[model samples]
Target: MRTTLSRRSLIAAGASLLAAPALAQSGYPNRQIRIIVAFAPGGATDILGRIVADHLSKAWNTQVIVDNKTGAGGNLGSDLVAKAPPDGYTLLLGTVGSAVTNQFLYKNMPFDSATAFTNVALVGEVANVLAVHPSVPAKTVQEYVALAKSKPGQINYGSPAIGGTGHLAMEYLQSLTGMKVEHIVYRGSSLVLQDLLAGNIPSTMDNLPAYIPHINTGKLRALGVSSAKRWFAMPDVPTIAEQGVPGYDAAPWWYVSGPAGLPPDITKKLSDEIVKGVSSPEVDKRIKDAGCAP
Candidate 1:
């Protein structure tokens, strides 16, 4: 049997073919999406990831989960997202180290930070506070630098981990000021704060979220904030740049990313959702409450 197709039917077929990609991306959240955190739970990275995931779940009416894949100084989780399918389901909540600096420090990387992931959206910006325990007797960054020089390796300063922004920030300060101090590495901010509160570590350049309360309480003397400008949460506090290290800026940050090669439509959709999640008035207040700049 021979059947003639209507001209309208042929036009409809062509339209369907043209709409395939756009349709696929527009209906995106038909399934769950997962954001992989490169560090363990309770750190600034984890906190910001969870905040973004929560807002995304609401925005998309689909579940969004945070999976912690800690190890290799945040490389393991980052590599997983880098190699995942570009369907936009799997994303990495990576930090400055994972997305930018780790390649220079590590010899064998599973994926190139610059090429393996598409920069989705920035999640949060945290000023690392250069703080010393109340007993340290340091009132300013210059004094702290002088103290470190006098004590050298005997003065212990802690960071979340090796190669983390906190560690690198302190190292950069050392390089600029010619100050030498022992570096203490912890698994995450919580553990580092534990030791810091106990007076086991004398000083740290840790994220502001974990140390802000102590700084306000006078338990730790905040010598300077690592941001180029003073952080909003503590407007009275000075930045390291203003304090003495001119032009110094090593603030910790987190960003959303997905495997490279994602379809442009889906990438844009995801980026819009992420930007909304972190920048909305409600979320912005929450991020600042957590002692970060969204």
Candidate 2:
């Protein structure tokens, strides 16, 4: 099973909200097209981006590359795509932050997400897992919360980006439980995972896919998942709501988009190809193996 929430369900939930305005362009992607992944390589976003790129490359007989542009909580890369020509040659594998949440999280946004780009396709959703290094004593979500409450701001947790879903999920958890922990934000999930594995950081609430192997290998201990219910890939792990906090859900979605002014014809082509690419047998298994719903 891919997820409790299916791909169609996620599309239904997010597509309308991300619909973009119409404009001009033609011939679609005749040359090499670039898909900008605004996070470091090896994270869920980057992995999914490459999956899309590979599929598109074969399907369209064009070279599709994934560029990792990391900075400013994904705004740097997002802004780059926003400012690029709306010819469908340059695209973005956008996360929740780059698409929606960063506007509210940041004081000054370089581009207006409202009109910057056209939403090509809603990729899928992934739950952020709240995991800690073995050094931490906490074994469950309640224990982790109690530890944080006792230490207050002393406990530090690493997140992929400032306004990204991982960061926001942690913020949401703190708000619901009144637990205080210092935030150690990184440019991407790989860097955060690096620090966490080396025991440089004690805990993290980040995308579950990147941490799954370590969690299974005993390098990390998963306290709880940030989704509303148990994740299909990690059903043994409980949700935060089940552990202690009720009604806690912070799953994040991914999508493909290009700059605004893309002609309706080009936009439809891109969206159709993306949806088809992700649904292919190979890509679908890859997404599910990455612990995301496809």
Among these predictions, the greatest lDDT belongs to 2
What is the per-residue lDDT of model 1 for residues 18-82, given as tens digits with 9 covering 90 to 100? Answer: 33355456778789999999887887888888899999999889999999998878998999999
Clashing pairs in 2: none
Error of 1 at 1 (Å): 71
Candidate 2 TM-score over all chains jointly: 0.92
- In terms of lDDT, model 2 sits at 0.86
Error of 1 at 55 (Å): 0.5
Question: Which run of 10 residues does model 1 get worst, by summed lDDT?
Answer: 1-10
Per-candidate Cα lDDT values, in order, are: 0.81, 0.86
Cα lDDT of model 2 by residue, 1-294, tens digit: 123223554543344443346423445577999999999999999999998999999998999999999999999999999999988899999887877788888898999997999777878789999999999999999999999999999999999888878788888889999999999988778889999999999999899999999999999999999889899999999999897799898998888888988766677778777788777888889899989987
Model 1 Cα shift for residue 183 (angstroms): 1.1
Position 133, candidate 1: lDDT: 84
Which regions of candidate 1 are displaced past 4 Å?
Answer: 1-21
lDDT for 218 in candidate 2 is 99
